[model samples]
Target: MEYTELKVWKETRLLVNNVYDVTKAFPKDETYGLTSQIRRCVVSIPSNIAEGCGRRTPKDSIHFFHISRGSLYELETQLYLALDQNYIQEKEHKVLLDQIIGCKKLLNGFINYYKTLKTKQTINH
Candidate 1:
C-alpha cells in the first residue's frame, strides 16, 4: 500500500505544513536553532513513514515506523518548548498539541498493525 494512503502519513504531512506556517513567525535568531530542529522533526514523521512503506519486510517497516513515532514525540516536546519561549500562544500550542496527539494515535495503530503482520508471517513459516 502507498504511504500516502495511510491516515498517519496524511496527518503528519498536514502537521509539517502547519508547523512550517507557524514557525515562520518565530524570532529571527532561532532561524537555525529551534525552528530548524522543529521543522526537521515534523518532516521526519511523514518521510520515515514513506520509507517504512517501501521496506521489503514488515519488521523493517516497523523499525521505520518506530522512528517516525519517535520523531512525533520529539516534535511534541519542541512545541512545548516553543510555548515556554513565547514563540507560540497557548491556543496555538493546544492546536498543534492536539494534532500531534491525533497523529500519535494513528501511528501507534499503524505500528501495531505491522507488528501483527510480522507475527503472522513468522507463524506461517
Candidate 2:
C-alpha cells in the first residue's frame, strides 16, 4: 500500500505541519536547540513510515515502523519540554498533545496489523 494513502501517514504528516507552525513562536535561541530537535523528531515520524512502505520485505518495513514509533515517543517528550519551557501556550500544547496521541494510536494499529501478517506468513512458511 502507498504510504500516502494510509491514514496514519496522513495524520502524522499533519502533526509535522502543526509542529512547524507552532514552533515558529519559540525564542530565537532555540532555533538550533529545542526547535531543531522537535523538528527532527516530528519529521522522522512520517518519513520513517514512508520509508517502511517502500521496503520490499515485511520485516524491513516493520523495522522502519518501529523506528517511526520511537520518533513519535521522542516528539511526545519534546512537546512536554516545550510546554515546561513556555515556548508554547497551554492551548497550543493541548492541541499538539491531542494530535500526537491520535497519531500514536493510528501508528500502533498499523504496526500491529503488519505484525499479524508477518506472523501468519511465518506460520505458513
**CA-lDDT, candidates in order:** 0.95, 0.93
Off by over 4 Å in 2: none
RMSD of 1: 0.6
Clashing pairs in 2: none
lDDT of 1 by residue, 30-122 (tens): 999999999989999999999999999999999999999999899999999999999999998999999999999999999999999999999
In terms of TM-score, how similar is model 2 to the real structure?
0.96
Candidate 2 residue lDDT tens string, 28-100: 9999999999999999999999999998777888999999999988998998999999999999999998898
Give the 10-residue window scoring lowest on summed lDDT in candidate 1.
1-10
Clash count for each candidate, listed in order shown: 0, 0
In model 2, what lDDT does residue 40 have?
Answer: 93
Which pairs of residues collide in model 1?
none
| True-structure RMSD for candidate 2 | 0.9
